[model samples]
Target chain A: MKNLLFFIFIHVSLFAHGVATGDQGYIQQINGINFVPFMYLGAKHMVTGYDHILFLVGVIFFLYRLRDIGIYVTLFAIGHSSTLIFGVFADIHINAYIIDAIIGLSVVYKALDNLGAYQQWFGMQPNTKITTLIFGLFHGFGLATKIIEFDMDPNGLLTNLIAFNVGVEIGQLLALSAILILISYWRKQPSFITYSYSTNIVLMILGFMLTGNQLIGYFNS
Target chain B: MFNAQQPTEKDLPTSAQLLKSTIIAILVTIILLVMVILPAEYGTDPTGVGKLLGLKEMGDIKMSLLEESQNELSQENNTSSIDSDSLDKAMVNNTINNDVVEITIEPGKAIEIKLEIKSGSLVQYEWKTIKGGLNYNLHGDGYKGSQKFISYKKGRMVQSDSGELQAEFDGYHGWFWRNREEFSVTVILQTSGDYIQIKQML
Candidate 1:
């Protein structure tokens, strides 16, 4: 059982930031408009995106009310959508590694905020909503840069992109619902108070791993 | 409408404690990155621990695959540029016709037939194995030992195939057939196209 779990962990880590090889081949070979496949790809991207999921988990860690969670998640959605649509259309190119590192830093920032480190170290709270929105933009750029790497055929480009964006939103909703369910169940347990702090620490470590990984990629590339 | 309690200020950690936790997180991250991630993802084993762990081989394979894929992408771009040049030149009279060749391959051996074709040139080809099926790769390589390669198609246990191939760049475009069966196989190739030369590449 331990070996199986270790094998799973290694497999997941290897694919953490990559499109599956078969899907990558499909993307390269296809020509013209492919709405459904692109949309599916978008959804798959979000469902497997560890960095985005980590940041979202950190954002909602402290929120207890559903209304507050909704508001925060919406802000994040809008922030990412704007950049994803505009960045691709405008052909705004950013180095993927740099943007992904920033995304990792966003995760780290949220984990620290959840730990109340900012309040203790700096004696002030950074406006959480604005920061979420800003980081959301960076996350969107990460997605956009990856798509740009495909050099996709321009036929039906706009419609395909829109479909992909819609798929991302749907994927976000599904992921959020699953996370909310898990968190709500965990909160009811007596261990919640004891384990919450440790969880954030783990999250911070993951953020650092992501950052380090991307920085290494940047230099290697 | 779940209402979980948020920790108040008094329940939060003190400044020194927060600092300590942050430092610990950083330290753990650094150790993992240096000892595991670097060697497993990029084959960069600075601390030598990854080599001992047998992860350096995995990293090496990943890096080489990445390099190969990047080379394929560059080759595509190079061919596309050559395609435009071919269009501008309008080589309508350059088409060659009915170039036929046959080669015998022993069991567990491979052979290649390459055509010197420019980007945008079109060719029609048909090949058949007389005996057992053979594995084949339709691929191209860049001009003058540029080392750029792109695979157009590949198959296993193929007895025959026929299709049109448009050159992506100025390169040697060809078929590689490997007879994997226990018996020898004879491949009869018929090609007619806009190409300068055709030869067996050993």
Candidate 2:
């Protein structure tokens, strides 16, 4: 598990700023109703998107109820989907590195929230649900920023975007399921209480690392 | 099953501890950025660790490759726009005529074929050796003095060639094929174009 976390940290930090070149090329060249291909691209992205997965893991780490999980996840989906569609169609552009840095912050926020850092340090508890939703919007815009850089063909843009969104949701569900199983089992272990703080601390560290990397990228770029 | 209560003191860290952790996280992030991220992402290796690990080169290659692809895409876009313009003009008063010619060349022999064409005329052509490969050159000479030759393309040890060609000047434009094989080879040339005549020049 330590090795895996280390691997993910290295992988995510290394290729954090951009999409794969071949995918970018395909997105740029293809025209007219490439629904299936676009959907596949979207699904592939979400599955491989470590930042999104990390944030999701943190968000659901403490939630024990399926209903609460569903509510939060749904809120996140709605938030991200709105901006993804709007940002692309309305031609709203944001610097990818800056948005990615904010996405990094989202992970840190959730980790800190899980650790009860707000209550401990500030003596106040912020609304986790609303915060999740807001960060979800930022996540969507993060994806939008990358997609817009592809300069995708405008033909069938709406259809392709919708299909892509569906694929993203599917990918998210798949990732969430795997994470749920692992955490559920971990919660059964006696070391859960002892290691939970350490895990959150690591998550926070990863968040800081991601943020720092992207900020460096932004300034250089 | 949701835990509704806010965190108790036991569930949280002290303010000083939290601050300490934050500072450590920041320091660690800076270290990673300097030793790993800089070299791996921007090929800017201050600590030389990235270069030692070859991560700096990896980043450099990625950056260069991306720039090259962007350059290629822009070039493709420019060419496609030009092609659309040419296609529009090509639709006006265009004439296409097809011709099939079979010529046999003896071993170590050569031949040239020319099509009388005006500048800016489009020709689609294909030529193949029935048995073996040959060296071929597609070229044109301007009708007037001082423009002796312009080469369009050339291939060696080629069995077949086919493509569209646009004449850049009023000239006799076509291909020269040389059979370097031991046996005589028959070349079948098929052409469809705006050319007026085909002349075989030995």
Candidate 3:
């Protein structure tokens, strides 16, 4: 638990800075069908994307079946992939900070849904799949905005984008499996119940933090 | 089937516990921002702890690089907006003497033609690439051994230019044209000015 807290703190601190200059230089300098490198970069981005991970964690917290997991994850992937391509190709100009804040709110929404807060307070359950897909669109737009800021060359852009999306899927799968394995083991412990509540609460708090940070950045910038 | 794994009310945290956890998370976030994010992103360190951790330099570099790149973009826009037509009207009224120099510059070759003029002398000059655009610089070099040089204008792929120049100091003043095209091209230069002499410096 202590190690996890340490990891979370470090991750949050590092993640708040956004994309590094080295990665940005790589993006700006490259052109044509740089499939492998762009794909690698895309995968690397998804893996390090704390916002995406937090949302994913909230999403699968209650799922026990592989089919259910597949359905939800695939929906998210579809939504994310479509918007990512469209946002970049259509030259969508939404501010990244705003999109990121919305992505943060998606995390908060999911955590609250996990805690059954909405169902309890309002005696209503929002459509989880649609909500997930919607947030996935926001997440995709967030990715698109960051890449657009990289000022990548237009040559072979479509091919590079497709390759990047593939990389994102690969990264997402790798991260999802790791979380699943860890959670499966934790579920067997007697402290799982106590820990789960605390964990979701923490997740919700992290979500709020992300939202607050991005909102502050938006106003300042 | 999807609803089977829904959590019971017992799995949820009490409102008080939730509020406490939220506060703790916010506190952690604030601490991290003060010590790390602000220093590393904006170069603003309120706690002074970021400097000790060497994160402040990272932030400083990021902020400076962003500002540098933005400045570069603006400079590019400014250069692109420099058109030959901006000085054409001004050059018409100041013409006093007309001298035309025509030269055929070979591919990948350059030539420097200058006019020896006195300080404060006014000159109206125009040049055009008859075949292809070339890179040109309008500059002044002081008298022999003085080592003084001043740039009046510089441009790339310019086809034509007309301007009136006021000599800042007594020196050889004029254009250096480099033919960047694959083939030879002729440059026609017309000048009307108060210069005492015209000669090819190089």
**TM-score for chain B of all predictions:** 0.54, 0.52, 0.52
Q: Where does candidate 3 clash, by residue pair?
A: B40-B59, B97-B192
- The TM-score of predicted model 1 comes to 0.56
The C-alpha TM-scores of every prediction are: 0.56, 0.51, 0.53
Q: In terms of TM-score, which candidate is stronger, 1 or 3?
A: 1
Interface RMSD, every prediction, one decimal place: 13.7, 16.4, 15.0
Decide which is better by DockQ, 2 or 3. 3
Tell me the DockQ of each model, to 2 decimals. 0.04, 0.03, 0.04
lDDT of 1 by residue, A1-221 (tens): 99996775444332221212244434433445666556656766887898899999999887756688899999998988888888888888999999999999998899888888877888887888899899989998988887787556576788878877887886787677667656765665668778888888899999999999999999999
Tell me the spans in candidate 2 whose CA falls farther than 4 Å from its real position: A1-21, B1-202
Q: Evaluate all candidate structures by whole-model CA lDDT and list the values in order.
A: 0.73, 0.73, 0.73
Clash pairs (backbone) in predicted model 1: none
lDDT of 2 by residue, A146-204 (tens): 78976776778899899889879977886787676567556656676668888988999
Model 3: residues with Cα > 4 Å off, grouped in runs? A1-21, B1-202
How do these models rank on DockQ, best leading? 3, 1, 2
> Residue A167 in candidate 1 has what lDDT?
72
Model 3 lDDT tens row, A1-221:
99996775443322211212445533532335767556656776897899999999999887756788899999999999999999999999899889989998898888888888887788888998999898889899998997898767677889989988998997898678767656655555567666777788899899999999999999999
